[model samples]
Structure formats: structure tokens, C-alpha cells
Target: MTREEIYSEVVQILADSFELDAASIKLDSTLYEDLDLDSIDAVDIFVQLRDLTGRRPDPEVAKQIRTVDELVTFVENEIAAAERGDPEPQPQMPPGAGT
Candidate 1:
């Protein structure tokens, strides 16, 4: 998906999930400071993002995201990487990965 499309979809997700005005969800809007999203709201948003992108976002990378634009950029990069046949990197694990 294009970055524009990803941005639009993210806006819709945030708006619907938080019952906010889509018009107010600009690129610079900070999820917590601007939108008043708490940890639970953030989890909901990330769940929706995974559904939309078909990839689980790296939690470590996600921590660096503070604004709507950063979220969009992360998703866009994941999509682009998938399109290029590169799997999004998964979190490292020791032996007995699921144990």
C-alpha cells in the first residue's frame, strides 16, 4: 500500500478506535499528548495496524514512534519491505523459542 493510503487508514483506525475527529489526526499529532491515548488505546491501535498491514510491528521499533507520522512511516516501510520479498524482521529468541 502507498504511504498516503496507509496514513488515511491509520487515521480512520485511530478515529474510530478512540472516537476522535479524523480531521484532527494530523501527522504531527502525538498519540498520547495530542489524542489522549493511554496504553490500552495504543494496544488497540497496534492490533488494528497488524490487521491492516498483515505484519506484526516490531515492539522495539514501535517504541521510537511518538507521532502519527512515525506510525505511518513504520507501516509504510513494512509494507514496502514485504512487497520487495523481504520479511519484516522478527524479535530475536533463544532456543526453545516458544517455551
Candidate 2:
């Protein structure tokens, strides 16, 4: 899937899993600070992410992905890598995903 699609999916997942307003979710919305997500919330989100798409984001790296933009970018890159048949997990990019 493309980056735009990934971003859309991320928004849906976060909104549903976190019980937040989907319309309020933005690129720079911090996952923890803005959404009040904890470790269990993170796990639920990741599990939903995996269920929706085959790719899994590393929990450790994901913790550092503070904003929606970073989360979207990371999932986009990881999905692309998975489609390319990369067997191993990719290295974690710093939060904000170069934005």
C-alpha cells in the first residue's frame, strides 16, 4: 500500500482503538501525550495494525514514535519493506520519521 493509504489506515486504527475522534487525529498529534496511550493501548493498536495489515511495528520503536506522522511514516516504510520480501525487521527510524 502507499503512504496515503497507510496514513488513512493509521487514523482509523487509532480512532477505533483509542476511542478518539477520528477527525481530530492529525499528523503531529502525539500518540502518548495527545492521545493518552499507554503500553496496553500500544499493544492493542499494534495488534489491530497487524490484523489489518500483515506488517508488525516493533513495540520499542513504536514507543518513540510520538506523533501520528511518525507512526504513519514508519508503518508505510515497513509495509513497503515487507512487500519487497525483506525477512528481517528493519531498523527503527527516530521518532517523527524525518519530518
Candidate 3:
């Protein structure tokens, strides 16, 4: 998916998952400060992102994501990396199936 599409999906995830106002989300919005996300919320987002992109993000890299823009860029890079076969995409499992 394109960057714009990815941004839209991210916005939707935030709105749907956290009940935030979509209009309030901006590229510079800080996930914890502006969006009021906690660590658990961040994990939820990562799970949704994995489901969307079919790739898991490096935990260390995921920690550095602070804003919506950074999250989008990370996802874009993950998609590109998958396409390049640097790390093969993993099979997706249904949500809650393993947990």
C-alpha cells in the first residue's frame, strides 16, 4: 500500500481502537503525549500493524516510534524490506488464536 493509504489505515486504527477523534490526529501527533496512548496501547497498535503488513517490527525499532509520521515511515520501510526479501514475511495468525 501507498504511504497515504498507510496513514489512513493508521488513523483509522487509532480512532477505532482508542476512540480518538480522527480529525485530531496529525503526522506530528505524539502517540503518548498527543494521542494519550500507553504501553499497552502501543502493543495493540503493533499487533494491528503486523496484521496489516504481514511483517513484525523489530522491538527495539518499535520503541523509537514517537509520532504518527514515524510510525508510517517505519511501516513503509517494513513493506519495502519485505518486498526486497531481506526478511521474509511470516504467515498471519488469527487474532487471539495463540494468546
TM-score for each prediction? 0.82, 0.77, 0.86
Error of 3 at 11 (Å): 0.3
The C-alpha RMSD of each candidate to the native structure, in angstroms, is 3.5, 9.2, 5.0
- Quote model 2's TM-score: 0.77
Ranking by TM-score: 3, 1, 2
**What is the C-alpha local distance difference test score of each model?**
0.85, 0.78, 0.90
Q: Write the per-residue lDDT of candidate 1 for residues 8-73, one digit (tens) a residue.
A: 999999988899999999999998999999877877787888876778777788777889999999
Candidate 3 lDDT, tens digit per residue, 4-70? 9999999999999999999999999999999999999999999999866778778888999999999
- lDDT-sorted candidate list, best first: 3, 1, 2
Candidate 1's error at 80, in angstroms?
A: 1.3
Question: Which pairs in model 1 have colliding backbones?
Answer: none
Instruction: State how far residue 87 of model 1 sits from its true place (Å).
Output: 3.7
lDDT of 1: 0.85
Cα lDDT tens digits for candidate 2, 1-99:
778888899999888777899999988888888888887887777777775457756667777777889878778767776789766555578877774
